[model samples]
Target: MLRRLFGDWRPTVLDVLLSLAVGTAGLVESFGRQGSQPGQIGDPVPMAAGAVVAGTMLLLRRRFPVTLLLALIAVGLAVRAVSGGGYYAAWHFYSTLILVHTVASSTEPRSRRGFAGLACVLAAYAFVQTFQHNDVAELMIGAVFVGVAYGSGILLRRQMDQTLRLAERATRLEVEREARARRAVAEERARIARELHDIVSHNVSVMTLHTGGVRMRLGDEHARERDMLLGVEQAGREAVEELRLMLGVLRGTGAPGSGALQPGLDQLDELVTHVREAGLDVRLRIAGEPRPLPPGLGLSAYRVIQEALTNVLKHAHATGADVVITYGRTGLDVEITDDGTGGGPDGPGSDGHGFDGHGSDGHGSDGHGLIGMRERAAMHGGELSAGSVPGGGYGVVARFPLEAPVGVR
Candidate 1:
């Protein structure tokens, strides 16, 4: 046990320290024995030698417990035979007790028969030593020492097993929680896809068909009106294509390699560049020590930034924008503020997204883009708020937790 401490193949510090302590105690007991004590071995040489052997033997207790106990018993008897009196070193006696307890606590000695034999021999050794002195106190104390050591070892084993069981149960519960969360997210995505496909897509398709039919019926004399109708028809087709892409993402069938389909914060620079080229002066600032986020979580944050920037370009008529990402203690915060419009979805320069009638602040627009952004935030147990900033500008802010909740709740 004293060879080393705390390496892969070395004994622990406790083991090494305990062995050293026991060995040191044995040495003191052997040399410091009283000359007047009744039945205590008088000769110091053989008893001291026996003490040292018993002390060293403790090092092997964990690996060869049976052999150690047997060796101690033999050394104790041999010391008795060599000495003038019938007694042996008292330090060896206490050292044997420690080894007995160690063997009882561990599971390496699997044979019950072997353990029973060891217990019998231990009891016999105790009785023989105590018999030398007819005092009732000596006999009782000796027996109590052996019993307590064995009982303590049994208790330790039970405690170790209970701790392991609790750790395993906690791991199982964590796995189940994650699985349930993913399942809920998938189910909600599927439902949204279904609504878009059945109702929204169908309505858009009918409007496009009617527009095409009307444009065809128009006469060549109405040239201006025909060109206007042609523009509407083209816009409707583009909207359908955009809807198809959104549906593909919701249904988990979007091509992974498509840049617009899957985006994480790692590609933030590209997004910033795109917004810059769109004629909106964009300033991207990040605060705090940024850490890697979960893939799905990063993607969600990217989408939020994308949507906010899109709104600023299409609705806010903003000439410049500020995007601030703060990696906070509990989670992350994304804020986008535009210099132009100072209202919500239905405010100045708004495209009528139909948000205010739903009890939103300054929102009564006939659009779903901002609503989709809010839904995305909520899916990750996050919140999104959009309105005018303190000054003469509009802002969108989203907050998401690092260790997010299991589901939307």
Candidate 2:
């Protein structure tokens, strides 16, 4: 109930009510004690009534600060005129101070000059009243009221300006935070794209090659189709597993203490076997004894090899390819090159390279293979290169530094 009646919005409501009630009672008391003496009624009715009106007007001071101030000044003048300076009619000085405070605190700096002019007029009137009555104490008291009210208004305005500045700063920070979140979301989507490309292309190319070989060996169409279907099924299942693993990481649902689904340098042997079984002659050579590598480095290495082998199967049509892993003291180096089958599917639409090597096919050179490989390598601050060897077929080479265990560098 108290808050409803006396909130920040209507600060002067209670003041207006109390002041008018008390002043009106005082006016009645003074009227009952009246006794005329020339221009003086031996009563305080006029003085009390002027106070009630002036205090009531305080309620509108904030809404119409200038107009209320003028009304307050008029009331002061009326009280002085009627009482001829008697019965503490000088208390209107308090109301004048209140008006000055409202003007100083509420009005903008440009309008404050007008308020200052009014304040000067009020000060002069107050000074003249005190001077005429020869009241030094009243004069000093009035001066202090003006000084304190004016000083407090200046300080209050400064506080308001500070609050506005802080609010603007908070707004700017919120905007920047939203922008960063959007950027993070976009980056995550791009990472997912690269992952899908790597998984789909590598698995599908393997399935295709195996299915083709099964057809040639077994002239029985049903048998060939069944084997091809099985290969497709297995590849798809593997792709799904990898995809689920990656999604688990993305969703922060990975096993406790586990991070991203990054199949690294150690998985090269299994990867090689999958291709060899798909009817390719794959020779694996490990130079400079194997060593542990960072998770991102290992994943990049694996993806580079996967893309290279997929390219060979699709474009070179080669029965053979070479997988060489050199583990240097500083970093890991991987090279995959395929001997092309004489004039097989070397033309465009065969591989992302498109034989003419100008990326002629609707499917450009940055095939799923190149794009995935590039993303993997760049993820680890590494570089990947791919192009046809000078004489015959295609080659993919990638190098990534393995400086630490597993974390962002």
Candidate 3:
């Protein structure tokens, strides 16, 4: 309830209650039979009007603190007019201090300072008026409350500034995190695109060449084989044309030149052989219904696997690592994990940023190649993730969607 009154500029239940309480108390004191002399009592009409104005202005102070300050000045003058130079009700002093605090807490530093100065002048004027009437008690009470109100206002303002600073800092950190990730992805994607272009172009060109060579070798007697080879040759040529068209979109988005011929799964055995020869015991596991993959996808899968194994060999420092490829109905999943116990270059407990930074933690984990892997998967409408795995090792996983070949289903 108090928060609503202090923290915002809306009409709140507490504002309503305070308005009613203060207005009613002031009115009752003005009109009710008091011990003061008859001449001290104010005219009923103007005093009642002042009470209502005071209550309404106080209720609106959150939204218009400055305006309320101005209104409080006017209302005090009206009440004083009716009192005929006699003492005013305590409610007038109470309302002035409350509005002063509201303006102090909510206004900007410059405006608050200006308003507070004017308010103190007016408060001193009111206190002097009371002092002349021999009311020392009211002056002392008003002084203490004004000081307390100013203290609380300053504290709340500092708290508000601190909260704003923290919020801005958090927002800036989030933006930096996202931009860092985006730069990584763009770099890797451009490279992946160039690699894809090289892969598909070479594979299709080879197929077209082989088909044409075989067709030329066939004699006129074997008309059926010649016709089949011719058809294959035509298809391969069309595929090359299509590949060229597809690569138009990928041309400008390239990184450095890749190997002349990107290796596919057919080269995995040789890769594994070299790793084993380097003294790393690596195991390969393949599951799912294996089928011939598109040139780009096959090369992409091979690259993902190769990168993982190379990281394990260079960074994992473990005796053994495992690679798994699972072909699903819609896509294939590749996962590589290492024990990190091999006392290798990166040593144990080192994890890469697959969300791992390559070689940052000596595990070639998280932030390492994450953007590239993500781009590769994204090329095929897929995704990738890498990070520390359970049992003191690191893992990288990538998924790529595959389209079944025409007439194969």
Candidate 4:
């Protein structure tokens, strides 16, 4: 609560209350001391009025600090002049000291030094008036008191300046850290893109060229082989197109091939055909009416299914597979299952049966493929899970919201 009141470097209710309390106490002490000194009793009303004025002026100290301090100092001098210069009362000294501290702490360096000098002069004048004998020890004590208040204010100002500098440094460091991380990510992505370009472009170009050469040499005499070669060539061309799209995405460019859209659920049939050509029996089933999904959501769903089917082909040793897509009011759910042992000859739990003997972590033994699928689903506020099915197969399932998050497109 104190921090909240004073944190902004402005006068508040607490400041007003503190001023009133100190002013009232000082007024009462001055009046009480007047009674103890013979013939020193003066007009209580004027003294009380002066205290009230000085205390009320404290409210504007933060906004008009120099003006208020100067006003208070003039009032003190006027009171001393009127009282025949014997000694200023305790309340007068208290108000003067408070104002001196405020001026020193709130003003700029030149102003603070000027105020401190003026305060020292006033302290010397008061010491001379109160101690007519000119005692050196008494003058030195008054000088030290004035110096302490001014020094304390200077110390506080320095501390505040240091705090601000440290805060700025911390903010700069945080910004630099974030910039470094972004640079690292961009560099890594570029490296991966270059490697992918080298591998995919070389292999796909070779496959497409060989398939085309074989198809041309066979002519119509070997129609079956020629037709198969044509399929191979078509598949190679599709792979190249897909690689271009992926490269464009990696490089932050739009999809390639005359603004063609990224592959989505609409391309699932072609994906299944490619897998079938590789000797895997797969069927796709849709349970509800399909709607136009956000591009990112559609793409994520397509990738999950593609990864699951590829896993089935390479690792599940499955003869047949089923791909089920259910579109509901809220979201879409995809399930890919295979009716074969959940392992290949080199895979875990490959005892010619299922993954019954393997642990739960066996599903993730296929490198980062499953992890990548899960990340894709999660990026769209969805989930993916894979495991061995109960009867004699493996299954991969993913769920995604129909409406992609904002900015995903």
Number of the predicted model whose lDDT against the real structure is largest: 3
Q: Tell me the lDDT of candidate 3.
A: 0.71
Scored against the true structure, residue 138 in model 3 reaches a CA lDDT of 62
CA lDDT, candidate 4, residue 144 = 78
Per-candidate TM equals: 0.51, 0.47, 0.66, 0.50
Error of 3 at 406 (Å): 11
Best model number under TM-score: 3
| Candidate 4: stretches off by over 4 Å | 1-9, 34-36, 81-87, 108-134, 198-203, 210-214, 217-409
Q: Write the per-residue lDDT of candidate 3 for residues 1-409, one digit (tens) a residue.
A: 9776567557789789879988898778667734456545635656667878888887886787667777777777766765665666667767777776776677655675556655653554464365245467866766677767656765787789899999999999999878877766665665566667677678778988998898899899989999998999899889878876665565545523344787778778898898899898999999987788877888778877777777676655677889898988778899988887434333345453223455222223245455556666778888888777777787888999877656657
The global C-alpha lDDT for each of the candidates, from Candidate 1 onward, is 0.68, 0.63, 0.71, 0.67
Superposition TM-score, candidate 2 onto the true structure: 0.47
Report the candidate with higher TM-score, 3 versus 4.
3
Tell me how candidate 1 scores on lDDT. 0.68
Ranking by TM-score: 3, 1, 4, 2
What TM-score should be assigned to candidate 3? 0.66
Q: How many clashes in each structure?
A: 12, 0, 24, 0
RMSD of each: 16.0, 18.7, 7.1, 14.6
Off by over 4 Å in 1: 1-9, 34-41, 108-137, 195-200, 203-207, 218-375, 378-409
Error of 4 at 382 (Å): 11
